[model samples]
Target: MLMRYVMSSLRISLLMMIVLGLGYNLLVTGFAQTVMPERANGSLILNDQAEVVGSRLIGQENRDQAFFQNRVSSIEYNGASGSPNYAPSNPDMLKRTSDAVKEWHTQNPDVQIGSLPLDLITNSGSGLDPHISPAAAEVQIPRISKLTGISPSKLKLLVNKHTEGRELGFLGEPAVNVLELNLELKSLMPE
Candidate 1:
């Protein structure tokens, strides 16, 4: 009689655990994440003979001299590389940012007037931020102009063109998506 009661209770508890576990995951992933709408429609990109190049929601990798660079990206555009976490005041973060500032300055000898953009040197907390502040984007104008043959004024216009103002006029900061700006540059640059 005692053994029978213990087995019955154990079976009941095991069944409840299985049901609740599946329910929790389904509610979070299936109902909440997948079913939700995203405001980011990826309105930026490039086309080489009509083939899509990159996503606006992802930061652009700095390589060629012609394009204005985006924020420092971790995982580097590889979806499989996974997201990077930012620990506030972490020593690693400090070291990385400090090193990047030096490297950027070393590479560009002409830029000498002001400090560098924080977003440009520091990785975004999510390691996935796709935009930079308008001011941050503006500082890169001179270098971009030198490479693309666009006037500084014209490059400023392009930066402004891609900048999105604060949400509802008060919620968020103005930002320029690098992917969109670069694609526009590709199309607008006089070949």
Candidate 2:
């Protein structure tokens, strides 16, 4: 009787493993691939030559004067890590924020700068945020306009064009995907 009970338990466990582990995963994968193949296979951005430049899910650092920058990344734009747990009173955090502010000032010397945008100076929680708040992009308009020779009005229009609304209406604030915005800026560059 005990032997029969053990065998039955083994059979049940094996069946559950096969169904839940293998079958469930395959079903989800198949559904995702059929429904949204591009997203399923990583939303890769391609250039005109069909070369994959980057993934839409990852943030990239754009230091070029002509390109709009993303938020300060604690992981240096790497997605492998989450936000740092540094307290506001921490010297390292204070120093980093101070340095970012100074760098922004240096970059926008000619513009009439006011209070710096928080998004520009602080790292996002994931440390891999590809999007920046609209206000953050707005503040950088002067620098990008000067560097690209694109008129401020046109640049503002481009920002608006690339800006994405909150998810499903009121979930999150509007944000501009920095990678997408930079790609658009590249297209607008004088050849």
Residue 62 error for model 2, in Å? 1.7
State candidate 1's TM-score.
0.70
RMSD of each: 4.6, 1.7
lDDT of each residue in 29-112, candidate 2, tens digit only: 999999999999999999889999888878888788778988999999755869877999999999999999889889988655
Model 2 stretches with alpha carbons more than 4 Å out: 111-113
- Winning candidate number (TM-score): 2
**Per-model TM-score on C-alpha atoms:** 0.70, 0.91
Per residue, candidate 1 scores C-alpha lDDT tens digits across 2-56 of 9999999999888878778776766666654455534233444548776667676
| Residue pairs that clash (backbone atoms under 3 angstroms), model 2 | none
